[model samples]
Every structure is written in structure tokens, then in C-alpha cells.
Target chain A: MTVKQFFKSNAFKSLAVLLAIVIIAGGLLAIFNDLLFVSDEERFNRTIEKIYGGSATVEETLTITDENGTFDKGAVSAAYKMSDGNYLIHSSGKGGYGGDVYLWVVVIAENGKFGGIEKVLLDTSDGETLLGNFRDSFYENFTKHNDELVEGKYFGTSGSDVINNVVTGTTLSSNAMCNAVNTAIDFFKSAVLGEEVVSYTYLYEKYVDMTQTTIERDFAANSVTLRIVMQANGIAPSIAFDVTVKDGAITAFEATKPFVQQYDETKIDESLRNGTYFVGKTAEEIAAALPDGETLDPAKLEGLGLATGASRSSESFFRAAAFATANFEAFFAPENLTYASYVDFEQSTFTWNYTEGNEVKMHIVMQANGIAPSIAFDVTVKDGAITAFEATKPFVQQYDETKIDESLRNGTYFVGKTLEEIAAALPDGETLDPAKLGGLGLATGASRSSESFFRAAAFALSNYTFYLTGGEQA
Target chain B: MNKYVKTAVDGLITNNATFKLVLGTCATLALTTSAINGVGMGLSVTAVLLLSNVVISLLRKVIPNTVRIPAFIVIIATMVTILRMALDKFLPDLYDSMGVFLPLIVVNCIILGRAEAFASKQPVLDSAIDGVATGLGFTAALTIMGVIRELLGSGSFFGIQLWDFKIGFFTSSAGAFFVYGMCIALFTLISNRVEYAHRARKARELRVPAEGPLDAPGISAKEEA
Candidate 1:
């Protein structure tokens, strides 16, 4: 065919049209890509707000590599330095029942005790895994466990906590979650705290010694009982404290042991300063006042100096106080309460019946905030006196099992107390009013969890319907 | 229904790519692990479908019949590449979640089938609507299947837990086949019933014109009594 005939041929026409379309489409796509592209900084900035809820800047991103080849795809992939001087590490958690799951953990950079985790946001995960944890607010339970971390204590958890055990038939998924968190914590310890980034996996292993720390919930008083018995990494004594928390408030911040001091310590007590330390101060106040690093705020330490060579004992007291603050704020968060988890949070007193062995079938009641079907706590009342209290599977995961075991043994606080007495004793929002709580000489040691009975009492009084007779009651 | 609307409805229901036409079976069955995942895959397909249809319809007059298949494929592949990049930049989470499915859109028989059967002859407007309807139909099918699989298999609705109950069987690829089969059976059953009812209604109208024309077969009639 002639050149003119070829130009008019169908083959030539098809090639020309196809080539034209490809070029035009390519140009258009490139333009769209440019217009719609989100830089890593911008993408992280937007995602960070969904997590933290305020404006924050990305300071520096610590790239994640599968260095030791430990995890599947999860690692603290990026660390952004925020404009507000806070650090948030974006980590990925892999290996769910299905495959890979991802999340972002925000580290609250406090000066002392390795700036702990402030919030955990499950960004993207397998649908099954998310359903099992998300709707139930089970991630809150995971982050709550982080509060029990006393850097000075024996390393990190061995990873086989009971809470990790009962995460909806997906323990491997839970392990992935714990590994992701540990990755971020390790990054924080090395990058921020400047400590040796120890590599003790906190999941899929037996805790170094699970028995060393206790974070029991006082079922009777609706309080968090803390009994930390462990030797320190530094000069601090083998410290112990029975820190008490009720309704996100500290009622008892007393050191069950002596507020460790080596030699004659400069007293911040009477005749010296009014707003000094310990007795007059709340744990939250002390925690808030505590500095981020080894040094206490010079002003707060005005009269009392870390007596020369007595830094261990003094610093230990400060660290204990920080932990007490975190335990109250993190452990007793209203989200932990089953009653507060229902839609009718104010009036959510749903109950189920549980039959005791060779005994009357008693009704168990729980309070909640959101409409989630799972209630956090269940209380049993036999003949108007409380008997047994059970926190649901998800809620139980929020505290250390050893602590709950210890706290539950004090069932005497609930076994005999009337519903009214239990309600009255609940730490009045944050103030510990033992008088309202039946003022029984329950133990001289401040086990911090003394008020759990009140939670039992409050649930019973609101849910139990005795005056109406054999009616179905929660 | 007007011609444009009918074209759309036809694409969405009568000639749905994943069900009736059975095109793009692999991606439909694979990416539908969650409700949102199904939607994500569906929307991506729709975007590519719409763009490709418009281009192919626009170029139909210039391409020869003998070389049209390769020409159409080239054009479709270009659109697919552009779409893949746009999705990656704009919807990174969706991009990651979709994994390999976005690039696989090029092989989706639905796109080429429409180009060959309809776009080559239809007007640009009609082709675009066809693309949308067909994409929507594919999306609707996948999403419904995803909803069933996600809800029954994992006890979740759109990645959110309604309860902690799972059937286990629905989460597997075999489970995808089960759900897909049930959906096709259900769709065919309903369509057959509607077709049967429409024919019956037409017969009834012929028997008695006094009542009126039957227009409830998902069609709105402008006829007057």
C-alpha cells in the first residue's frame, strides 16, 4: 500500500489512537497523583490528631527495620517529634489469627521512670481481631497493663499474663500487639530516655517473674489496690507501697514501707514548709509535680535536698509516686468500669443470674457507658449482703491478674458489707472517706485497693430490687 | 426508565461483572474479607471502569475492528496504571489494604467486555453510565458478600464487632466460594422471579387494559390509564 493508503489503514489508525490515549492518560494521572499526594509528615500529622486530639508536630521519625527479624511486619516504623515537645511512635503489630495488624502507641514523656505510654490507638488491624478487641474496648486493657511497668522492677513482663491469655481465642494476635508496644518502648528507652534498649520480649513468654508486682482491684471499695514489692535497678531500696486508687482518684498515697531515706534526711514536714511532700500531697499531685529525669524540680525540692549520697532512697520515693499517679490515672480510667461501658451509662445497671453451688441463685449487676453488650464488672448479692464479684473477660484483662487475685481474696470487704455501706465507702470521687465506707479496721497497711467494696456496694444498691419482692433484679 | 438510566441499571443488575457476567472473579473473592474492604475494591474498580469507558467510547470511531482488542487493552492498561498511582498517593491506607488487587484491575474481564460489547458502539455518556452501573453492580455484590462473610465468619460488621461470635467457615477462601455461590443463586432466583412476574403482569395487562401498564419491575412507566 502507498504511504497515504497506509496512513488511512485501520491498523495505523488503531495504533495512533491507542498511543494518544496512553500519553494523555499518563499526563492526567501524574497530575492527579501530584495533587492528591500526602507527604509522610502530612499523613502522620493528620493521623496523630485522630489519636491525641490536639495539634502536634512531628519532630523526628525513627525508621523501623525488621532488624532481628523478630516480628512479621510490625515495628516502631516511625517516631515523630511533635511541636508540643511530645513523642509518638508509629508501630505495626503483625501475626493475628488472620495475618497482620497495625497500631500506633503514644508515649507520654515524663522525666522520671522511662516516659510511659499515655495512649494506644489501634490504627488498622484484621477485621476479626479488631472486632474481638475494639467493640469491647479491650485495647484499653492492654495499655492499662503498661501502667504496671516500674522501670526499676525486674525488667519487663514475661508476656504470658492472663489478660493476654483470654483475648478472644487469639493469643498470637495479642502477642503481636505486645511486641509492637515493646518495640516502641524500646525505642523510647534508647532514643528519649537514653537507657540501654534491652530486648526482653513482653509477649509470648513467661513474665520475668509475674509474682513481683501486684495491681489488684479492690472489688469491695471500687478501688485499685497496688502492692509493688521489688528491688531496684539503682540505689533505691527493695521498695514496696500499697497505693490506693478509686474512681480515677488517689485516696491513699501512703508508702506501706518507710518513705526510703538513707541518713538523716532534710525534713519537708512541719516547721519547714507547708506545701512540701507525702502527707499533705496527693499521689497525682506528686506525679504531676515530678520532673521527667533524675532531678526533681528545684523549687519543690527547695527545703529538702536529695541528701548527699542519699539519691537512691529519695529518687525511689519519687519513682513510686510517679507509678502511683499513673496507676490511678491509667488503671481507674472510667473506661475500665463495666457500668460506664453501656449506652445508658448513667442508668446502666444490667444484671445476669449466676447460681452458686448448693445455694440460692443470686443476681449479678454491672454499670456501663456505651452500648457495648459486654459489661466490665458483675457483682453478686446473697440475702442483701455482697458475696461474689466477677469482672467480665475483657474488663479483667485491664489489671494484673496477681493484683486482682490478692484483691479478690479480701472478699470480706464485700462478703459482709451491705450495698449502702459499700456505696458510702467508695472514695468520694477522689477523696478517701473511710467513715462513709463502714470504717472497719480492715488492715493497718495501706493496700491502696481498700475501697473496691464500694464499687460492689454501688452496683448492688442501684441494681438490686429487694423491696419489690421475687421480681427479676439485676 | 430512560435510555441512560436503563443502561446503568442493565450494567448494575442484568450484566453485573462479578455475578451475571462472572468477570474479575479472583479479586472479588479475595479482597472481600471485610465490608470496607469490599467497598474499597469496588470503588477502585468503578473509578477505573468509568475512566476507561469514557476513553474507549471516545476512541471507538478511530480504531479498526481487527486491531481493536490490543488497542482497547493498551488503553485500559494505561488507565489502570494511572489509577494505581492515584490510589497509592491519595488513599495510602486503602492502597496498602488493597495490596495487589489494584494492578490486577487491568485483567478484569468486565472492563474489556464492556469495551468490546457496548463502549465501541455506544455514545460516551451511555458508556460512562454503563461503566458506573457495572462497577456499582460488582461493588454491590462484593460488599454484600463481604458483609455476610465478615459478619458470620468474624462476628464483625465493617470491622466493628457486633458481638464475639464467629462461624470460622465464612472467613476462608472456601467460605468465600460458599458465600459467592449463595449470592449468585439468590440473585438468579430473584431475577427469575421478577422476570416471571413481569411476563405474568404483561399477560395480565394484555388480558385487561382497564387496570394499567405494569411498571413495578424496578421500572417507572410514564404510561397513563
Candidate 2:
């Protein structure tokens, strides 16, 4: 049929009717679409306030259209908010597991320090891979370091002790989040702080009741239990007190939780058998091994490990040891004259230095801040006193070059090698040794699988800290 | 009753706009996604169809044949626009759901076809009945297709769940084509059979002997005697 004849036909006439109807309907719709626009804007504002933890203003709002941007009617929009009060801000520099790096600005002000992260959202679509681990670990990191930040330190977590660092194949996402927080900090300093030369203080408060003060001295138990609560409020509310006997002789003193030095050496020695450290060694031997001179510095001892690449494994060990020592001091130290019982943090290691075989007496002290207590192990070296020696903990032994080669060439799991062991096995001309792998294990031929394992391990280690500190018993 | 009313009803049901006449296939396909949508579209078209048919019938004597097509189109457009606004304000959901199909009804072959054919020759009441009956038939056909499609494709009847169902095959665009094919095949078969039976009956009634069968027989008998 001719086109004109077809158009004039009854069937075509009906088809034309339907099309005409739809056109009219669309025109009517275009007229009322404006009414919904206002409601959508209001909903967006409320969502921003709820999600970003503050009131946000819409400086500019416009309808989304093609060729302008990628945003759609339902797509998210960007906005900014300003603080209502004074806040203390500090930066968190973290080396995420598997060589990922992150930076963040933790703000603590008004109510408390590390006032938790004001906002943490993935700004990069490419960084979506890190979402599972980074998002999971965020609140936990805040909780773990809140008090520490309040005390003026940016504590870093290592291994499973912090939140999972190697998020499900999303190292880039981790970096993006780190960058976002860093950007926020830079933005705050430049736009908010702005060359203002002023001094700020962090306030702490302690509440104490004299009527409720009780001191129990158990001579036979070689311990004392002193229960006291103190409250003080000021610009910086920390209160330091020294509890002394009536004759002015110091009995026992503690700050917040008693430090390592405040513990009675004899009582600590007696209680040594019960600590996690004495699980492998006898109490008498462990007490005897306690260095009489200054503690061995972990930073210096790291130099003794096999050198490879940049010495990441050695650095990790030193860091792990420092965190372990801090944990040891926090939980097990005595309170007042009486030695108070505390939870055993067994996931870390401790080290000290002493002279042996006439070599210059070594004094070492380790200070790792953000690893679990279980991963900690001690290594003792005496000059010419002992022949060849192995790592104090088999799990912490450094792998030799042969072991590293086997792992790299054969794709075997490098389970127990320490940084020194891995470092010694670097191939000639290779810039990075296992020590420099940054908490990642060598599975060379099986890089992908090894990377997955690293990510999983990092996640597990980070989760462990949160699980323990959540104060919930499983 | 008037012979014209009966003629229109018989024409619409037996020579239906969809089944027999096949006048408005576009509206049928475009709007038959659900029974509710099809009915709304059907009724709106029906109103415009009735009004336009009557106007065309009333003006048949006055209007010259040269401008008849243009005159019919203008009338249909005016009626469709009014209906569109009314639907938008009162039955917004249907209006939205009908979408562009609502306005497109102005060009429907069924309405304009009747205006040009029966309405232009018939009286006002007869034209109105023709419009209503034909529109009703079209509505019925579309509603049937829509109901089947919606039920099979989405497990719903008029957008309401009839039963807890999990028919995996009906959940995609493929299901829509499947339903359309089946419905077309079924409706076509039914209409063909109905039309065939109707034509066969008419043929029998109109059948005539080739050469005066009785007179030829009588002559042959006489010659044999």
C-alpha cells in the first residue's frame, strides 16, 4: 500500500491516535514536574545533615542536565560544612598492611579528643574496593585511639591489632580515604585555622571521693588494692597525684593507669609466672632475665637484622615490640602499693638489653604502639657469650635467603620468617627485600594469591583489636 | 428500536475494530501493558470517539467533502486535549501511567475512521451508538490483552498480586514478547473462526441454484418417460 493510503487506512488512523495521546500526556507531565523539585531539595538537605554529622548549607542547587555533569535526579551531590565550636585536630599517618598508606586528620574538641572522624566517605569511585575493610575499621580505629589522641599522640596500629588495612583488593580505596581525610585537614587548616597564631589546650577531668577511698594491704599476697576516683575539670583536666605514706615515703603512685615503673619489682617478679610472657620460660628465669641496666632500645636493635631494601620487616618488629611493651605496662602494672590484677595482653613481645661475654654492655628499649600482644616476641643477643642462637619465638624467626628464595621461586607460604630472615634473601640488584615488603609475605610465583592472603590477614589482625576492645566476651 | 442502533452493534461485535476491522492496532499495542491502563486509555478514546463521531454526523450535511479530513482531525484533537487535562487533575496515576499514549489517541483510526465513514452518512444517534459500540469492543480487546500480559509478566492482575507466585520466565522483556505472541495467536484464531462461521452462514443463505434445478430435472424425467 502507498504510504498515504496506509495513513488513511483505519488501522493506521488508530495507531496515530495512540501516539497523539501519549504526546499530550507527556506535555501535561512536564507542567507538574516542577512541584516535585522543592520536595527533593529538602530531602537532600536533611540527608546531608544526618550523614555528615553536622548542618550543611546548600550554597548552590540546580537541576541536573545532560552535558553538565554525571549527576542524575537521584544521584548524590557534594557539599561542605563549618564547625560550630573550637576543636583540636591531629593527623593520623598509617602504613596499611600490604604496603598501602593512609593519612587522616583526627579532630578532638569540645566533648573529647579524637571526637571520632567527623566524616569518612569514599570520595573516589575507583576506591570502592577498600570500602569493606576501611569502612569496617573506621569506627574501631576511632575508639582505640580516642583516648590516646586526647593524651596528645597519634597511635598507629600494626597487624591485626588495628582495623583491617588490606581491604579486599582495595589498597587504592584505602589511599583515597586517607587522601580525603588529609584534604579535609588541609582545608580546615587553611580555611578554618588560617594563620591564627594562638595556643590551645585539651581539658581532662578526674573525680575522687575521700569517703569512698579504701586501701587494702595484703602482705602475704604481696599486693595492694587501692580504689580511688578523682574528678578535675580545667582547660587541660589531667590530674597527677603521688600517694605517700604518713612518713612521706612513697608507697605507690599511678597516673590514670599505673605506668610500668610504678609496679613493685619484687611483686612483679612474684607474679611473673602468671603473665603471658612466662608461658614458655620459668618465672625465676624470666625475672632473672629482666635487664638491670637501661632497657634495650628497639630502634637500635633493628639495625642488627639482615639488611635488605629499606628494612621494613625490622621496622615492623621494632614497632610490634613497642606496642607490646605499652600493652604490658597498661594492663599488668601494679596500682598503689598493692599489686592490682589486670587482664593479660598475650599477643605482643617485650625486649631488654644486658652485657654478656665482655662485649660492650647493650641496653635496648622497644616502643611499638599499635600491634596486638600475641605477635610480640623477644630476641636476645649477647657479645661472644652465646654461640649461634635462634629467635626467642619460633613464630618470630627471620627467614634466611634460602627460605626467601624457596618462597619466591616456588610460591610457598612464608609463615614464620621475621624481617631479618626475609631481608637476607633478597635477589642481587633487587631494590626491595622481604623486609621492605611492608607486612606482606612473599609468595612470588603466586603473587595474586599471596596478595589475597595479605589482605585477609590484615583484615583479620585489624578486626582482632576491635573484637578485643569492644569489651564483649565471645 | 431503530434499525441503525442494531446495525452498529452488529457491525461492532461481528466486524470488530480490532478483530475484524483491525482499525486501531497502534493504540492496542501501545497501551495494553495492564488492564487498568488499557481501560483508561480505552474510555478516554471512547469519549472522544463518541463526541467526534456525533459532531461529524451532525456536520455531514453542511461540510464540503474537500475539508472533511481536516475538520475531523481538528475535532478529535480538541476532544483529546480536554480529556488529557481532566485525567491529569483527577486520575493522575492513570494519566501518568497512560503517558504519551493519551494524547496520541487523537489520531486513532477507529474514531476518525468512523467519522469519515459511518458518522458522515448516518444520523446523530446512530453515529453515537456506532462510536460507543466500536469503542467498547476495542476496549474489551485491549483489556483482555493487557490482563494476560500483566498477569503473566509480573504476577499481577490490574497491578494487584493475585497469588504468591514465582514464574521466572515472565519477569523479563522476553516474557512481554512471549505474552504478546500468545495473545495475538489466540485472539486471531478465535476471530477467524467466528468470522468464518459468520461468512459460511451468510453464504448458505445467499446460495442460489445454477440453472433452475427443478425445471431441468422435470425436463429430463419427461424425456425418460
lDDT of 2 by residue, A1-474 (tens): 999999787667555654554465456545644432335444444345544446434333323223221111111122233344332222222223233222323333344322434433222131122222232245344444444333433222212222333333334445444433433333333334443211111001012222232333232233323333232222222222323121112234333324112222222222221223222332122222222211223343323332333233222222222222223222222221110111112222211111122111111111121231111112222322211212122433222323223333232333433323333333232223456565655544433323322222222222222222211111
**Candidate 1: regions farther than 4 A off:** A1-14, A55-77, A81-86, A91-104, A108-111, A114-144, A147-181, A198-474, B1-5, B77-99, B150-174, B202-225
Model 2 C-alpha lDDT per residue in residues B1-225, reported as the tens digit of each score: 478767566555666777666677766665665677768877887888888888778778755565668667777876787677677555654665565577778888888888888899999988888888888878887788778766765567876877666353443345445665676577679868877777765554444254343345444432322
**Interface quality of candidate 1 as DockQ:** 0.12
The Cα local distance difference test for each model comes to 0.59, 0.42
- lDDT per residue (tens digit) for residues A344-448 in model 1: 233223322222321122223233212212234455666666666654444322322343334444455566666556655654542337566444554534323
Query: Which candidate number maximizes DockQ?
Result: 1
For residue A3, what is the lDDT in candidate 1? 98
Model 2 per-residue lDDT at A425: 37
lDDT for residue B150 in candidate 2, whole number 0-100: 62
lDDT for position A403 in model 2: 26
Candidate 1 lDDT (Cα, whole model)? Answer: 0.59
